[model samples]
Target: MTSDKTELNDAELSRYSRQILLSDVDYDGQLTLTQSHAVIFGLGGLGSPAALYLASAGVGKLTLVDFDQVDDSNLQRQVIHREANIGQDKVASAKTNLQALNHHIEISTVATKLTEAELADLVAMADVVLDCTDNFESRFALNRQCRRHGVPLVSGAAIRWEGQLTTYDFRQAETPCYQCLYKEEQGQELTCSQNGVLAPVVGMVGSMQAIEAIKVLLTLPTLMGKLMIMDAHTMQFRTLNLPKDPDCKTCRD
Candidate 1:
């Protein structure tokens, strides 16, 4: 039977039939995803998998923002960039790969470091924002913008054997934001270049980030106020409640 809300052509129906079979994502939910736009910051380890899955799942538009080039070391975990893409802009490489995955999707690339104003403008244009950057400054800036624009943000981090994923539904008055759990100056940055991350660990976290983004786009229940932590050594996963900080300067308003 065809859906009254979404008119899916034969191609679209065949492409997404498996997901549509699930009770959580029927025809209407699939249409919601196909009509949504997501802006992803940082096209590295976390953003790589997130962007791939979101595009594969048929998100209509994707904006890839990153200023770095694909390095030899990135191939260890950044699956979206192949060896041939070394020295190319990460956003460019990711755009090429994502478009290949889903030809019907629209992909935009921002190959420069985004200033606060530029980032805010992009975040405001998106239905959902994914924080895949590897630094506190970018995360803080994105969090502020998401709060300001009331856009949902799916945040993920992977370092060494530890990884974490969380979602902030800013549209919900009581949801905790990224700043509520992390302080900007609490510590020096620990990038994969320094601390080193397990390859699959980032994939796991990034894949989950995509899941949260899809749920937010479809208006389904997501990890809005919870954090999922993973320890790859023991393969243990833990969920912790994230409470909104009443004194958080970013979201306390």
Candidate 2:
């Protein structure tokens, strides 16, 4: 396997040789993963596992954005950090772990919440964006950024063993944007913090979210324009096809 700079060492090549075995992601795709950049907003439960996998997969460049810090409560779901990192910044802790996973890649950390200023620029630079935030405000911000930049976003959410997955890139004709399904019509969403969430449930969803994100970045088939629902309680998976909304303020393009 070719390396970004130095050739992949025996262990390095053997470690990822399985992923490299796939035809779509052969040496070329591995190179693409190593040379590509992705931004993961919100380093909470979902972001934790997703970011870890992306980093371990040798995704050349990774930008982790989160404004929070590690807390005892986060340990149940946020496996990226341990109890020793309780007081440390989430981005800092995650960066350490990610780099340890693969030092060959570059890790970027933004210890701030998603803001309007310069959000579009980051989205434009990322090959794919992962939205793992818990609140509607951050989620909406990411949605608008994806729409504005025409970057594909694989969003995942898990609360209490139930999760929903969706992919959207209005750049494609007749594809639905996030707001098409959720908008000012709803009063608000029931967040996991307010309700509750299962530990492994977030990992299950977050891992799948990473899979979709990698696919989007590698230009492979993804779950675009479809919503996947996982009933962890019953271990059942269902797909809800999304239809384009002609009047969707964000996806009408």
Candidate 3:
């Protein structure tokens, strides 16, 4: 199921014709996408759309990680899972749908929370990692791993009517890790179950995460050191610079 093709076959060209039409994602870019691997850590609101787009866009392989099972309450925003999958593991549900979307791509699922060592192994294998996970603990753990492996990380979050998106291209010396933006002590994690969220807000942020991931694989310009904030209520979007923390424990030399 692994893709190591340097040239796109006729079927692939037709399947991704629209994307290949873009000057930036021409034949070469499309081929690059088909040869890339992405690891996603979550299958809820944010991970759902992010996984969908990456699969449809022809990322060669995707590793979905989520220990939670599909719940009735998740239907409102976790679009990749269906009502029939209510009791299924989130990663399993996501794998089924993503494969249905693109059988040409390889999809793997991890139905358990990964230990730091396990997480590091996966991050080291990925061309890009999407931090669709919730909670500061998971975010900080992933940030440290991505920094250690020098893999780009696309992090997104949505709670209530606000959403945030950022990329940490760890391959670059000056890029900031997640800890640089929000200290561990500053994390007062909020959840949709507790605070409630507008469904489309997560969809928007997750979709943007997909875009940034593709850009990373293509070596195109991305929000590497910038954070994008969205207020769905006001329908306004803002991008701010995210500078590196010289004292960042995970990324500081």
Which candidate's lDDT is highest?
3
Best by TM-score: 3
lDDT of 1: 0.89
Give per-residue CA lDDT, model 2, range 17-47, as digits (tens): 9999999888767767887788999888999
- List model 3 lDDT by residue over 75-111, tens digit each: 9999999999999999998998888899999998899
Clash pairs of candidate 3?
none
Task: List where candidate 2 sits over 4 angstroms from the true fold.
Answer: 1-12
* lDDT for position 116 in model 3: 82
RMSD list, candidates in order: 2.8, 2.5, 1.4
Q: Give the TM-score of each candidate.
A: 0.96, 0.93, 0.97
Q: What local lDDT score does residue 249 receive in model 1, on the 0 to 100 scale?
A: 77
Give the alpha-carbon lDDT of every model: 0.89, 0.84, 0.92
C-alpha root-mean-square deviation, candidate 3? 1.4
Better of 2 and 3 by lDDT: 3
- How many Å off is the CA of 222 in candidate 2? 0.9
